[model samples]
Target: MVSQPHIVFLTETWLSNKIPSSLIIGALPYTILRFDRSSRGGGVAIIIRDYLSYSTVTLPSSEHEITCIDLFHQSAYIRLCVVYRPPTYSLSKSESLITCLSDIHASSPHPIVIIGDFNSDSLCTHPTPIDRLFLDFQISVDLTHCHMFPTRGNRCIDWIIANDPSLIPTISIVPPFPSCDHSGLSFSLSSPQSPSLPSQIRDFTRVDYSAFFNYLLSVDWFSLFCDCPDIDSIYSAFSSAIHSAIDLFVPYRTPRPPSLSYPPHIRRLIKHRDALFSKVHLPSVRILFDQCSKKLLFEIDKWTRYSTRKKLSRVNDLYRHISSLTKPKLSIPELVSPQNLPVFDSISKSNLLASEFASHFTLDDGCLPSLSSSRVPPSLSLFTFFPHEVYKSLRKLSPTCSTGHDAIPQIIFSKCAYALITKEFQSALNCVFDWTQCNQLSLSASKCSHIRIGSKQASPWYSINSTVLPLENNVRDLGAQVRSDLKNSSSIKMRAQKATSKMFLLLKALPFNCPSILILTKPMFFHYLASPFWNPHYSSDIATLEKVQHTFTRQLFYRCFPSPDYPLSLPSYSDRIKTFGLRALTERSVIDRTSSFGINIELTTSTPRYHSFPVRISRWYSQLPDSIRTAPNIRMFKRRLENHPIIAHLAKLT
Candidate 1:
């Protein structure tokens, strides 16, 4: 007897980066899950190996259902449930368990396996209605205990219960310790088989042939042969027929136990049967070829009269159709015939008995059970499990462009700024130079004009519009005076100049690490943020706004992109964009929360005050390296105004 593999489960662990990485062993391939319920903390997770793939499910607020996927194949499905029963103190503990199981059984196909800490032991020691209901529910669902741990000790609270006894579990309890309240439970599956195959066989030589033949003679064949008088004579005279029929109908014989080893002839026969079963029985390749060949011959004849193109097409089509019939038809034959007979022969000794066993048995490793003794359901609720608001904001900040190309905002900003610096935009140069304190020689319109003659030179403005009394030099002098007036006049204005750190502000407020930003960023990130003005579609005002936004944000991200060792976290709303199937901008933006952090800059109202400012962290941040300095100031400012309950949230974000 060979031992079957195991399916395990466990959960409710609040995993953090602080814990050492350890592999869950004893069974192969362990699954680990971590979910925090809310900011306050209450989440459910499960780990299962094999059995089936896992998915998330959502339950109503009042219900505590073990949400999982239900895949149905024919009459049965492989169902595993990972349950997290809150400590006995919660009011709805039993209701949660019952409702969860009810939903699972109702929605999923069975045979079902529920593994986890139920926090209850036995019916005799049952502590709550939910535990009692679970027991009754198991009974109602026809579930049985193939095995349980601590069978002889105090009542078994932790369990691996399933709908089918054939799917019973073998459990090992991990010793309890002072650190954790509950003991770790491990479970394995038990092989479902009878001690041996039915040992019945039949023999033909000892049967009474004459009596059997006489019985067949009483059937209504006389009517069909009424017109042929020779039929009665043939039946009455056929002695060979009786013997032939008797040889085919042998009595069943009880098989004796099989020998430990096979004779050479028996092994050869077994191999022969296996080959025949593969080629002729299961796929029945020989039979398919025979049938397909006949069909093809008919099709060729039928399509031969069509035009040349038509004939060719029809021939190809028929060939493809005939080919398709081969695989499926062959599969049925292969499945019906027994391929491995020797294994059965070793168990039953008799060749005939082995043959019978081979016809009935099939081999499958019960769809790989879970690694831990815990039962893990297939699906979980994506919306409920992940942070929704933060994810939404990230989606807004990073979006697909009209052409569905990734236009990184930072890249766009850099390009625009480089262009402004290189291009001969006099106004732009004037703005930048004045702001930067680079006061140098200034060129007026008059200084830009010059003309030459045979013996003398004169200003171009005077040469073009001339009068003797109003000399060319005097006209140039007047033009120079006008240009200087424009340059120095207090009335001449500049585009409303506002110093903003909005882009940097957004970067500082990112809820998750930079990696999350990378994940949510799309080509549209560049299109809207970096080149909004370059798009002929928008007015100059809009374009200028876009330029400022792009410049600041691009620089911010370029400076703060996380180091390789420390990856950034994804914003919560990104889950909606990727996993929830919400793809459109309108859908993403309406509920987006990360918008404020997208560009990190804000416009301030023009106000003047004569008041002392508080001595705070902002002053401290101004002293650090230029790289991390701005981020700290923005963070400190935000903290001063609104103290977020989550302290050092950025640490978690990374």
Candidate 2:
């Protein structure tokens, strides 16, 4: 089913009405119909691929143990049915079954395929009264049995009887499913062909960054922005410059289509299994082939687990691996309109999502009082941006930061900031909300969010035009969450929870059959699970992060080394972490992250009155040794600390 067969049918499914279709199929792209028995056991189901147009057929009441679907393929309709009859059912039932088939053959204006377990063996060779009746009916209806081999126990009890023999070329029987007696059958249907579609391709690897930078350097900044009267004009010019550079330096080429290839181990296993199946026909040899098939399946499962574990061992690689493995999620949160009606259509749903987001950030126009006088500074009105100053500011911008709503890179605004652009930017924003005829732009109120750094009482409400903007406790900016309290506890907790979930998953997925491999992979797994939380530039309470790390480490240790005598002389948690060659989430490590960001504490004239991450980091930095304190920069200081391991350890103690 995962390989996406065109159609599937099952008999003696034992599925009851109580079982939902979602539980049975679960997001597979298929339309299903089932005929469940009133009592326990003996049921049938038919599923057709979603790409094919299909509908349920209203069968006669005589077809009690049957499920049927009509498939529309290439301007022609085909009736497909699945039937199941228990061995305990009376021979008289065959009369109704034959009548149902006769009626279907007469009524359907298309080819018919009837596949099922009839519980009658060798009907063509040795016929009972009911078997002889079916044989006579088959001759009259021009039906042919497609199954050449026995479906179960040296008897052709199951069948694929089709009205048009040309529809099916050949039927191949595979081994029986685990715990099932009947063999699985596969057949290819002749269908109309369609032309292949060409796909657009881009090769980003050929981009020349050096050429791009040179192009950027050659652009005349003064000529572009000197006469620009508004922020929009300046933004337009900056964007044009970057885009032209990209167009010149980045080469776009269409490459040949990619070929699908399996992993080497899986390919080898498949080849081995095929060789065994092709050469061996003896009963003992067939059994060996079946065993080989099972072994191949097991190897594939093990390889998948091993590959997942290996990729998840690195924090940077975990997201990509998880994304590739994740199934398309169906449980989207339902959106409702203001009138309490469900939004189903894509356009309405999008509008609802936007409205919901706006509701969170928007405040009533009457919530805040208007200002009595002009609040804009006198000096800000005369401030003009210089090209040189803008260039310097842009250089300070982080290359990795994301682009803004205008599709302009953050570096552009960062560079613009050097020439007192903040005042101009605010003026431009105000112009957009002035509601005058000249107002050519409008900002999305929902997309904009603000966080107050001080006490709520001290903070004043902000508004664009008459609409007051809602205040937030924390808001994500430049890829990191900035909080009013400036503590990373919330961020750290989120990371810890995510890591803990992945760690538990790893524990559950580890193969107990290979303990040596598990032992070897433990350190890699630990690093993969824990590194993301600590690597990012965030400040968390050391004790809190340590507790989270400790919990995960303990669980991992117990799973990897599950011996009764192992903890008789219980070692310290830190010692156990060392034994596993894993790094501990210590207080010093947390402080070091802040230090790496070039935060200086000794420069502070007074102790910070408020408890914040920056204040805490400053305090930690002031207490460090002079060698670290007087280092040229954050990177150099980090390198020094890395070199003097004993000194760094002692510094943590302080």
Candidate 3:
């Protein structure tokens, strides 16, 4: 159902001149003809079967990327043209394209078909000048549009218009190619297309996660983490175990196509809009037509919003949604070498980077400050990681399934975390710094430091890799600042300054005055200020954290409100939050913690309660009713908990 088309007519390919067309087609029995847009937007291409005899036809203007070709089929010529008119395609350019198409139609003796995304918004009653011009040209040529179903978010923008109505007997909306939003148009022109082979993908849902976790737990991971004796063997054993688990558990199934057909009420609205579209020139009919069109478009938008909300409700779905919004990677063709030559090859580029880095370094003097060796200095160590700490970190891991250079997916680690949090796993993490055992990750000797907590003067010199470590009063690690005196006032002040700057920086960077854009982009804000679900934090710390959000809502109020004298007119923060159906960040965090605790309470029962977090978690869990605690998933738990007195005051924002 996905890839059955012979002459694939693709609109808005966005192919630029930089990429070679040959690279895209690969070693296929098809030839591609593309009109690439130089800067951005409005690119189109058509891939035809190489066995088919076809000749390219020229248009008068090169303002838009359009493909026109004449195909010789059974001793008769079929003039086929694929054109895309972007919503942003200027009226003049639209007119030019139509004029060119008109002239070509006037000259050609063979039956012609112009098919592509016109961005005409077939559902909208009041059409733009471009849509009208395209329609007028279609009417002039006596073309019949065979796009029966809506494509491109409630609008039948993509159409296959033919001069001879019988040329295309039928058309239906099909699932689009992977990564495409617009649905596919499958139509017949004398011959029916062969059904595409259904593709198979790993059915992750079928895999028994609980069983897999238990299997991994039963294995003696001490061999892999500590007893492997070498880095290479450790890596190999880890990889092998992951692969073996996959072979034994995960199953494969053919992917199912998503529903393309819209609701009947929407279909009715579209028909009504199309019917009134003919008499849009009449003022009285135009009003009713526009009302119908607005209602239809609003309905589609409403569902689209609901889908977005559903995505943001869960961790996995949120990750997928974020991935979808990621911008296209910028391509840099070459790197400059010392010789002022362009280095295109990967090896040369790596060499250039390595050489530059190696050359740019400060000379280190082979000297050490003399110190008293009589007294031994105390040193902090991470020889063992507590199970609770490991479990806490593991549960926070997003199952995006993204892998680093290790070739192991995060989902594997996350889903199997409950079982994988063994003493051996803890050893593996602790062994990250143990150079004698697993020398996989070498610490930079120059960047290494030692900070003595008790004494102002250094006790003794510590050296690694023949380099002496520098003693410092203050050091920052993983975005947290630590002082030898163990004071946090300076760190708090620094954080406040940084936060203030960032808040102002964001305000200056974006204009939230436009409520429409702000509403559309509100999900991003929710993601930024996420509900902390791990454990309940101190009230003081929570209040300090809430200041960030408090500042944001304040800024948002001023930016979104239109009043000149805003101070007196503005409502209190609590009222404002309630009006927006949003809860305090602390409230959200508490709810999230309770919900997470409810999901893992049974699994964590055997785990030793070494930390105060578990005690606090139990207290919070006790507050919840039996129904809320027994809920199947975190999503359900949170929903059920929202009705309790603890979280009932907080409204569901989405």
Candidate 4:
């Protein structure tokens, strides 16, 4: 108690039901959570400080001697478990305890720490059954038994295991407590640092791009390292020039000052109170100072509470209010089939239960009743023509044919669109204003852009609310690129560049192992659209996309297998794919398309066209086997697709 330890875990408490926890805790404000076996000399207890918000967790499946608690702070929690395995522990008891620990570790959002007095010496010459089990558990769950020193005498029975050892940086063995035989294990769990406001950054928004572009052009990029024979020398020289250009053009931004917490009136009152305190020697000043101090304290307290409540009401109160209204009434337990066997797999159980539940109900055929003499709902139709398109149409006209309306010849107007363009543009603006006003909203000028699509290079300036928009040749919408000429070149190029930058960033920042690398990159293969972009239409685009995966696999190979292959030619992409047992990006795209098509085969669209999703994927989707198409869930669909190899062989349509 004098040491003021935040928490204390004890094993072999030797206390029974008659000994209330309060008697042991005494007058200290601490929570004593105990899990006692029916017999004596086998119990676990955790004494946590009263201030921490925490709850005791019980494992129904685990009948062994173990206790767990979740110490929470805001959104994050740390799960601490205490274990006590007797020297006479059975093989069956060890398995159940280890299984319970594994479950807790897996379910926790943050890494957990487990400390115990297992009495199984880790430094024993011959490993016991419990020791073997612990070793296997450590390997399977990626946990570490960090304690190496002896706890009781020369044999180390006490252990401190954690799912992530890096979290607990400092580990030490301290002398045993009074009347205690086992030594104490002291360790600290490091919390991740809270995010801080950035003090400085390159201000790219105000960069002079024109000068930067000129600087880049002036550099002899093609003549990089002409005397050197290696590609590394050329790449290094090229990178240095580009980096210097960026540093010169991009300006650094100054940090903004922190805002004042108190309002103006409260701050003024505080200053007045402080000024009075300085003149406390005078009797009148003392009286005024005391009054002002009280009032200032009241106002400060009110403002602080208001500010805190306002910040929390936006999230915490709303979630709690909503959760109270929608409480779950039913819970499904394990189901047994007619054959008296329990349904263990999630997919099979879900399908069986859904079918059983639906057997008691009926659904409508989804057909509307026919009516006589019914009027169709009216829909407002609008037609639009680009100004450049109108100019092009006028250019194809003959000068001999005079314009019917406005009495103007086509040749004069075709020479320059100034006359026709201004009147038409004003009319379009009026329509836009009317539409936006009717909707009771104004479009953001920053969110809007003007672009001309198709092969024509004719682009006219467009404005919203008297603000001219910057013309863009290409724009990315919903993570898919759209270009002026509808070419895949810019779209694929941007995607490859992003993928390369993201891949290297992940590799450099994260401390993941070899297998974790593939897991991290698994989510990046999917292209946003199910359109032609899914299957790159051009040969160059396909090569560019495939190279991302190839380069990744090559990097992974170099990291895993060490050899004198630095200057040696690496294996081909196909051989590497076989070596790593991974499918190609194009192959993955087909699988994705096939599964999507299978799910939406019966879905009908009003404006179905040749380039529509279902129509485009029909070729690949139609060839899939019935088993894969009929799969009930994503997991089953993936499992079935893996068994079928012909889907990977289909040539992508250009």
Candidate 5:
């Protein structure tokens, strides 16, 4: 009520005559019109926002609890009625309610909206007389409960009914109010709003690297930090110098407009339809509204087909966009502390969730080896920071990557890679490390995890700073989850499911039986639709992925040719490939994986066979023909393999 809804209709408030209005609607910004039972357990209330001008309408009969109000908004009146019929109420009471509704309809020339918990499930075989009465009144009742889960038992007894169905607004069932079994319903009459613009971001790819490096070189570091006595002072001076260089060289750029949720043409049609609907009472306006609505729907269908065809031409981009749009939203579970006490407030819930995660990750210090007793290798000295090693490390950091707990951007580190190798930077790094070690200011050992990928039987545990960091069977590293067995079955299955979902969505968007367009787009669909599921770096069993691709292809074939006996006339996998110029998943994966690595196959004995790039390359190399294998150099061998008829054909698909 305090949030000031235009009109709120509450049923079964359970307020008796004894409970005063001041107690129920205390300090709320609403004018209430309620029908209360003289005894216990049956009541109805309609709370209108204070800004709205409304008057209570007296019913001819008061056999059942009902609240009627005529609300004035934007120079128009709307007859709002809230009804609550007790289960024990007789058929006569229902008839009386319906008669009151008829009287109100005859008196009010404006649009009418009736909302209530009629305590009748219209879908039930034994329909109540109240339901029949509503049907007789020509009222449209929406029995589709907004809540997916049960509000009370398994039935949706509450309904929002309107004389004109279109006036019944969009309703959302939010979480139940405290101690209430019924979920709260929030609704709005307005049409959906357009999506707001995305935030502006810098285009780092367009940065002038040559100008940036030249600016860095021009900076006289010795002159700027001549008076600095300590490592900290030198670090500050260097940071300022690098930032100045960056500001001079790096220019900001605005990206192209983001994709609209609804196409502009469709939005225009919807606006036109809504405008016509507003003047629906007039005979001319009513006819035009009907025509406009039909036109709007036809345009939407036409646009959907056009957009689907366009997206199918660039299927990879479509899949990526859909994946981003359908990414799972994060929601916090009901927070409960270790003591089993429930937390209600958002701040408390957030803190409890963080604490629970911390507790799960925290390790026992007693289980770890003492740091004092541990031997430190002379070559692994923290005091010395080699400029070349520092430069290499900084260069490896991705400029577009996320920041850490320190809130320092990766671009800052990447831009200053050259400066990091300087003597002053090295000294500063060593000083920071020494200070951290002395004061125990490093990240808590409990907050960090150590993962060892190997056979499950031989999984290893690790310790840091005398605290044993917990070992995990699965750990997320650089966005991909790594498992102890090193098998990519789970990852492959997840990717396949996502791809299948996206394909189905695209199929739904496109019109069926457009054989010419489907044929033209088939190759593009296979090439890019499957790209999301194919990861060159991850080793997935070829047979599993092939099955997924084969299933998708078969479904696509059926869609394009929807005859009942289509499968009987369908060609074999190889025959279809030759006819459609489609490549097998195994060949496509091999070609893509081989091409990604190029000729830089560095074999290391220490690397695990499953994860080793050289091992994979060697396996593929063994399958090559003698002509490709006999090349004098790695570069020539790669060229020959890439140009081979089979590999070249498969590469074209990718």
Candidate 6:
């Protein structure tokens, strides 16, 4: 290791015409001389160890590859010359190189050492006698006199020629590094030292930080501040302002919120105006805003007139901008029809809606079905009534040992009614009618009733209100009697009781045609009297589960089911019940007429018996809708029912 050696990396030094006259050489721990030769295309470089001082001498024009490095060491001058010879084998190569070396040796005040690439075979083919004689005068150590292969073909070309053997430097051809084709050479001599390693490295030592960090954690962190006004409120205010501004850019329906009128162009104008306002030197915000609006309006007008698709708002953010300008000026007069404004038109709104809804329905040419006058919509037929005999036959069927009620006809009628009124079915009406004719009851009804039927149209239930014939009345009254009998007649009641558990199973056997109505009305059998079962949140102590059935009929007057039109379908019932419960009591007063409407039927005189029965009509007809319960009227009814001890206990059931 050279304790203080100059290390220089010379690049592109061998390329004659291709190489530059000047090159940058990095000489670590040394002083470098970056120079250019006047005659040579690639120049020679010399570096001296930093601890050494050197002086240089100018050489003759022919002397191109000559660099002298002088060092003051051991109180004497030590000079070194690093040289390079051209690659040609011509005599001129030897002449030029030898002349350059001789001139430097003659002029030098101290001994010189030359080390470089010399294309010559010295030991094997001795130097010409003339060159050998000249080199001997200096008595230099010609290291090239020995053979050391530096190339694949084993050529001795690299050499160190020195004036004296004792003053000769130690030289070794370093093993080739991966970077270059030639092996590197390192030469060094001892030198005195100054300060060695840096002080930062010497001073640092290991120390513990656990206790210090623990003390830091123990501080009362909350006490480190003074009270300040809330920052969150300010941030929220800014955020709301931004949201309001953005919301203005989105167009809403015609009856728009007072906000959302800020046109994008107008907003941009306002922002520009505000920026100019802050500058103070610019025009007033009012003037600047007016100018910007005029400019934007002109541009928007041009865009609207020229574009095929009418999207002026988006063309240049014109909607929100124009809206922003006029929003502040909005007043009662502007609300009528503001001029130069970008209001959402009906056409645009419809287009927007069509664009939004188009994804839901697939309508190709082949999708439309053939239309025929003979054909009828299923909705018309679903609700179409069977001849009167059908109901009569249904009425005659007795309750079974399993299913309490025959549900098929009822479910079918409900679905048919729904289809007809709601127009929700897609099948032909005549087909349904033809199918119905196949049934025994329908065939008998057709022979008896002679009701006019057609695929084009049919008389709806609502129209029957006007046909108040005695025969129709008798039929309706009979149907009502049948329903009432199912509820009141002891023999049928006993049969139903036996099949009560099978009622749900029977319901499954019924038609899915009027599933909505089935789902709506099914719960009424025992579900409406849900108070004790549900444990009415109003009061649990008043009614216990065991007493529920006995007390159920008493609460019937207070209880109500949904109207037939709304149907007691599960989803609708659930949603409506929740809505009714949450609404103000007065708002929820609308009566469900189907549950309440009926003539008073005194089925039982015993007060206890009345309490247990599912139906016990009050003496007074239930004339009013459920919604009309004012305090005074409610109190009056409460008193009236209370006076009747039987009703008083029933009211508590619900």
TM-score of each: 0.28, 0.39, 0.33, 0.32, 0.37, 0.26
For residues 449-508, what per-residue lDDT tens digits would candidate 5 score against the true structure?
Answer: 756654323433445555666877777666455777775566666555555554554444
RMSD of each: 34.8, 17.8, 20.8, 34.8, 20.5, 42.8
Relative to the unseen true structure, what is the C-alpha lDDT of residue 639 in candidate 1, on a scale of 0 to 100?
39
Best by lDDT: 4
lDDT of 2 by residue, 1-654 (tens): 223567788998887654555445544565567898888888998866555656666787744688876666665678888888687766677777878878777877789999899887645576787777777788998999887777776778888899888898878876555447687788877753332435544466988778777778888899889999999999998998887776777776766753334587778767776677555467888788778778777877777567656656655554443333232323232344666344558999888778778966634444333443666433333333665544444444433345545333444333334234444445554654653323333466666656777443444455566566687898877545667976555665655565555455444444343333444434433453344334333334455556655766676567666778656755678787677655555534543554554555533333332234455556555556778767888788777765655444543542
Candidate 1 has what TM-score?
A: 0.28
Candidate 2: clashing pairs of residues: 393-415, 394-415
lDDT tens readout by residue for model 1, 1-654: 011223334455543322211222212233444343433333445543333333433444434424343222233345666666655435466755675676666664446777666666555553565566667777776666544555224566566777675654455654332234455565544422223646775566577777776756854554634655676665754544555555566577787863333345444444443344244323566455344444444444333223222422444443342233221221111011234212223334465556777866555435543243434211111123455542342333334312212222222224344333223233333443343333332334333443232223232222211221222221233212223212211111111122123233233323223333322223213233322112111134333433443444334344445344432442233343443233323222111212122132222222111110111122222323334323345555343323332323321221
Q: What is the lDDT of candidate 6?
A: 0.40
Better-scoring candidate (lDDT), 3 or 5: 3
Supply candidate 1's per-residue lDDT for 27.
Answer: 22
Cα lDDT tens digits, model 6, 1-654, are 122444353422533322222212111334444344445455556654444445555666444565665544555665667665556435665665676677777765676666666545453465765345434533553322222445312555565566554564455454232333454555443433433544332111232345434544665434432232477755665565444443433333333222322356645654664465344333576366456546655655454344412323242343233233222221111111122222247776566557668966544534334455656443353344775543443333323212223232332334445444323322333344545544312323322221222222443332121332121211223222232212223322332333333233323222222222233322333432232222221233222322322222212212334334432342332244343332211111111111333345556554433533232224222432234222245455444433333332333333
lDDT of 4 by residue, 135-213 (tens): 7888898878776877776787898888778767888775444346676887776633333668887899999999999
| Cα-based lDDT at residue 534, candidate 4 | 47
Instruction: Spell out the clash pairs found in candidate 4.
Output: none
lDDT of each: 0.39, 0.63, 0.63, 0.66, 0.59, 0.40
- Model 1, residue 91: distance off in Å is 6.1
- Which candidate should be chosen as best, given TM-score against the real structure? 2
Tell me the spans in candidate 1 whose CA falls farther than 4 Å from its real position: 1-8, 15-35, 39-42, 48-76, 89-93, 125-131, 145-148, 151-153, 176-178, 190-654
Candidate 1 vs candidate 2: which has greater lDDT?
A: 2
